[model samples]
Target: MSKGRGKMKKDTNIRIGTRGSALALWQANYISKSLSKLGVKSEIIIIKTLGDKLTRGVLSQNRNRGKSFFVKEIEDALLNYEIDIAVHSLKDVPPDMPDGLILAAVAKREDPSDAYISRKGNFLDHEKRKSIIGTSSPRRIAQLKHFYPEFSFMTLRGNVETRIRKMHELKLDGIVLAYAGVKRLGRKEEITKKIPISVILPAAGQGAIAVECRKKDRKVISILKELNDRRTSIAVEVERRVLTKLEGGCQVPVGVLARWRQDTLLVSAVIASLDGKEYLKEKSVMNQNNWKKKCDDLAELLLNRGGRAILKSIRK
Candidate 1:
């Protein structure tokens, strides 16, 4: 048994499983440092996931791939007791977890906005007809279409640096990416524009880091609990519940943003078709005391308001 955080001491080091990507390593290191504050020691174990292996083409090109593409292998390692815990970008985690695994904690969130990066002048100054944006997210595609119907789009895939490098090499107009990723990679200056959440709701759990451990591993969970941010966890929970209720995955053209305002929780979500032809959005607020019910209500509201039809069309 290893020592937990704080005064609790264990004899062994906590093994953290993470994807080998730079961003993933950063997140894992962040967790390790956080644990160190409580006097716990940890080691990062790099693991390759399907998402890491399929770097040849855009993820959107594969309709058969599931939401767990980036996380299944890591979860498997946790279940097999090969690692003590798994660190993941919450956006990559599916709403449902494998039977024995649980989301132990959600770290404090980063900037949740999406950013526009372009080698050309400012993206907004470019001519719409000539401007070609790059992104693989259907959510971004749909929302951007709603705002700038004249713009054309192409699939852009790769890590934060790779996308930026490809953008310059290909001399493409611009690419959309999560601002959190850019900031994590110390490339904040590359942002040409920060798309507001009002215009483009972020993906569920977009800016949060999640820690996963086996449900039976009480010691690991206890150590992780010290690093959990309560507000971030609640916000992401509401967002993910809406996603789960909608039966949407990370690849779905669904966007959700949730926040705490005063004593209330506000949730906004959107569901759209691949072509951006049909879109449904809903926003609701409720006292934090009824967060779970509010999440359900918000999902029901969206579903009743054409979201169901749009989701069905997307699945087909």
Candidate 2:
């Protein structure tokens, strides 16, 4: 029995853990294909997380429950040696990782913008008054309020397909979702409009898939490194550092978007109150070689300029 267990641990096969949602499976299969190209094999194990189980309440209401609501269970599986790696939607991951876990690689990013899916024509049409939009993200709600103060929003829960279904079933005027998820599921045709990042910055690490493993799993890390996109990883890291410095959680009404252009990395971020009555926006640019310093400076700039107070108000 001991020898059999040892063999299993030493096997070349890698087991990947992920949420069972359609978008998650798509990400897992993508990793699998990427590994296959390198002569490695992998199997995906679907795991249900606390976030997945809580299908009724708005995520903001459960913010106090703690961060890592979506990735906790999968990380547990990895710690117990049940899965060699875990795949997560980078935006859902908290900035601080568990003691034994590390984000090993980040896949290439897709469009990081949010999509507006509306049944009643363009959502931004000034003629559309008193429109009801569906979203569960405080970030989206606060930012949208800043742009279209007249629109009312309701808490939208469920997977992408379920949310779209509910949009029709509930007779909602429109819904907001990540462009990456819709594009991954091949539902791009349903997008009524792509909300520009200029008007609404994306969540930190949005549109990127992260692969995590135990810190001691050097072999798996080495195998996964080939899939990491350097530019995407750097961009996401800058955004995540801002969130970490701000001590923001996944549900906080904070939005950050970062990109690399020419020889510079530019980051735009916002921290807003739930009511959108108070907010702060900061844009920082620096040479790519000094990305870390730029991220720190940007975070500090926001914090000093009412961003700290906005965060405090949100917590209260």
Candidate 3:
């Protein structure tokens, strides 16, 4: 570990737990660099998971799937004290953390928007059923089908780069990926179209990087806290609280976007059917003084109205 230059200067080896995928490595390395700026050196520990090994089809399409698809392995490492901190894509994390784990810090959120990588055309061309598209998210699949039902949908498997390659080699069409991942991987140029949240709502915490560490370790938590972004954390908390209230733990097709402006938080959530036919959308503003309460109440409203039915439908 390199020594820091000032008050943070300390000889420390921070183990950063992350998936072994290129996109995951890129995110972990970025966080490592940020920690170094605060005078703490970080070593990235690659994690392997069932989700990464299975590249046969859409993860959401698997009935036996768990929200831990991208999380379980690293969570185990944290539970066993094999790593000091774990960096994750907030969208893929289950609403509930392991009993002893903590979501201690979150990086500043990214675009929180979806990006489309079309081969040589646009979604409209596909809307005409002239092309086929591929993806792995139920949220995207549902919305895409709703908007462009005539186009064919297929399962997308593998890591970010591999999926990109798969789309090109199979010559199917384009893929829908989070803009944050594509940008972080430095492949922004590959994006043929960047979808805005106004049209395509993103998965909860879509573009944010979350850090999970053992709840009892204050030293590691303190070290990681130096990199937390206040505004991003607040907004994501709003979105996450909504997920918690709705009991959306990965199998559910839920989406949300939260923004903070003038000391107020505006959050929107959408619950949809697996086949992209039915949906219930809601948005609300939270007073700066009682953000959590507002977020919880709004989430409750959605769940009671039609969210429960949607959940039951997806389960079958």
Q: List TM-score per model, in order.
A: 0.93, 0.95, 0.91
Tens-digit lDDT track of model 1 for 187-210: 999898888887789999998999
C-alpha lDDT values of all predictions: 0.85, 0.86, 0.80
> Which of candidates 1 and 2 reaches a greater lDDT?
2
Task: Tell me how candidate 1 scores on lDDT.
Answer: 0.85
Better of 1 and 2 by TM-score: 2
Q: Which stretches of candidate 3 lie over 4 Å from their true place?
A: 1-11, 55-58, 61-65, 123-127
Q: Best candidate per lDDT, number?
A: 2
Off by over 4 Å in 2: 1-10, 64-67
Candidate 3 matches the true fold with a TM-score of 0.91
Residue 157 local lDDT, model 3: 64
By TM-score rank, best first, the candidates go 2, 1, 3
TM value for model 2: 0.95
Query: With candidate 3 superimposed using the best TM-score fit, by how many Å does residue 34's alpha carbon deviate from the native?
Result: 1.1
